[model samples]
Target: MKFALQAKDILRNYANILYLLIGITTGCVIGFLFGNQVESIKFIGDIFLNLLFTAIIPLVFFTIASSIANLQSSERLGKLFAIVAAVFLTTVIISAAVMMLVMLAFPIAQDDTLRNMAAQAALDNPVSSNSNTSATGLAQVLTVNDFSELMARKNMLALILFSLLVGFATLRAGEKGKAFATFLNSANEVMKQLLAIIMKIAPLGLGAYFAYQVGVFGPQLIGVYAHPLALYYITCAAYFFIFFSLYAYFSAGKQGVTVFWKNNLTPSMTAIGTCSSIATIPANLLGAEKMMVPAYIRNIVIPLGAPIHKDGSSMSSIIKLAVLFAMFGKDFSAPEMLFAIFGITVLVSIVAGGIPNGGYIGEVFAITAFGFPMEQALPVAMVIGTLVDPIATLLNANGDLIASMMVTRIAEGKHWLNSRLPS
Candidate 1:
């Protein structure tokens, strides 16, 4: 009992720092020392990776469908979706712009040596001797491909579409949808419970995964990713402050940003630690309540927003793509970049939302979307995963904040909507 309490306290208190530090340290150390012998450790990492996605299909369908079913009307749902979509679209565009600016400001010569080294390391590191039982290595997991393949692969993004469709159908089904809604409701609740249980083991899972990685790889990653990573982090922070602050101010009005931060910090922290937005939903709702977001919006937007509208993820995707482009000896022309910003980022954000490790998934999607070779994806993903997650968490959390406020403003019958629309 005492041990359990102590463990709980540790998780409740220092879990994020502990998770990050231990992961980096352990992964570097283990990757360096054992290099490939940490089969058990690698297995533990694999389990956590798979664990993230295990409940996703049911959870997404239930959460989205039930939320839609509870809506006052489909018209309201449409209006809300329209607003959310517009906001998300704008966010993605701004994100791409910011990333492009940052990439231009601080262009790092592509380190092919680091990329090759990381890839070779991934291929050579036999973390588990039981190859048959091993899940695909992170390298393989991050491999880039064509956008067509990405769309066709039924990856996470595809699953999200199916979930949304299921949700919309459930809402449109009238009384007959009750049974399905009930089932979905039950499924969502069950998944939440399962996730709660999984979170208890999170510290352990995180510690082992990072330890094994560092243990295998050494501390070189810090240096290798230094400049580009720094640029990514700084740009994301700037976007959070300049853009999201404005969003909060406009949506919520005076004291809006404060309220937004208050409601979102816990979830943001949770996301940073877990690197899983889906996992942060419970905390996000609690936070939204603290912000006094209305039920109509909170129920409708937050859950829906969690999956489909990822402003932060979109930012990371654009930046990573630019990084890859720079790395691959290609200067992003005006047209190519415009296409990347408008065409790729928007579509990829919607598609990559379903992937487990969604933040990294976005980066991988960027690589594939732009027709990059598969080998480049993993190295870039590792760098982005470490560099981008905290910012993404902050942005994602703030997006929830912004969305809550936008919904609140709309619910109160404010003139905010008119400002964005035609007179």
Candidate 2:
């Protein structure tokens, strides 16, 4: 009876995660049997992504605007922002450090076959035009020229800035803005409910996408550059298990670790299946709620974190830089190269965090900044980026949940879990 009771409790709590696992497993089997034919079912996944993406634009706006609008004072919000920045920087550095060790332990070796294939592929299919990314390209990314453009997903950073401005204006309005503030809160709650409804089909959606991916991309996973792939995947796995747990424990001791794992797996799986940190924001927000992080911290942390606070990008950037360095026979550990690699890792994570495939911009930046021949280096970097993307995104997406906890602990004190949320 005791064993059965415990089993029931576990099932009740982890039902969603279990269903996601089953869905993915089923998708994998179907994919393997059908091979590339499974791509036909990709529309099933596309529907889910479209629904989620459409919902996200409004979700982000309302969540940020509402959370900030509700803050009692600008000082409180400022403190949270300061803490969020500190936590993000600290975690990114730690991720880079850990991967630096991993690279030293198992460095990438030059593969003539891989290099030759990369050269041929580059010739046949020119890489994206990011190799010449200019100042105008960056302006288009950061802030759209028109107000209507802000609604688009590609302009997330701009939307966030606008949301923050709206929030500040509402707060500054005092008594006159009470109705607007209330509406913001109500709309945010509605969006939250809408997200919950969308998530019901996640398993099915994720399954179909995984089927398509496995069918199409599985063969490409194992090749001459497999060493770099293994190194990246293994390092991500270890970092998540070890460092994530440590972050949780420090947030609120053993209880933090327990709750985090309970809230974590679902979001992590969603991230992996979707291969997008943006899509994972809804899950991450829910996880933060379960962990009892205040709205101010989570609103700023999770949404902002999705784009900028990517430890995964930090690790992978180092790996990509090293791989290119090895291919070119450059000393990766040279003092100046090490310094440049570290700076570039942080820059890429921040500059490229919000946009889809923004890493291409960073790769271009790296290639040009380091004086690597864009024609030769860009293709290698793009291939490695594509390969490592799934796991790297997993780290980047779920990382926000842990970061929210850290921010709460720092800004609200260690007893933040039990303390009254700041008004």
TM-score of each: 0.60, 0.59
Where does model 1 exceed 4 Å of error? Answer: 1-76, 111-221, 262-264, 359-363, 410-423
Q: Compared with the true structure, what per-residue lDDT tens digits does model 1 show for residues 249-320? A: 777665677777665667777776555667777887888777767666777677877777777777777666
Instruction: Report the lDDT of model 2 for residue 317.
Output: 87
TM-score of 2: 0.59
* Residue 341 displacement (Å), model 1: 4.1
Model 1 CA lDDT for position 216: 51
- What's the true lDDT of residue 303 in model 1? 83
Q: State the RMSD for candidate 1.
A: 8.7
Q: Backbone clashes per model, in order?
A: 21, 0
Which candidate tops lDDT? 2
Clashing pairs in 2: none
What's the lDDT for all of these models? 0.61, 0.75
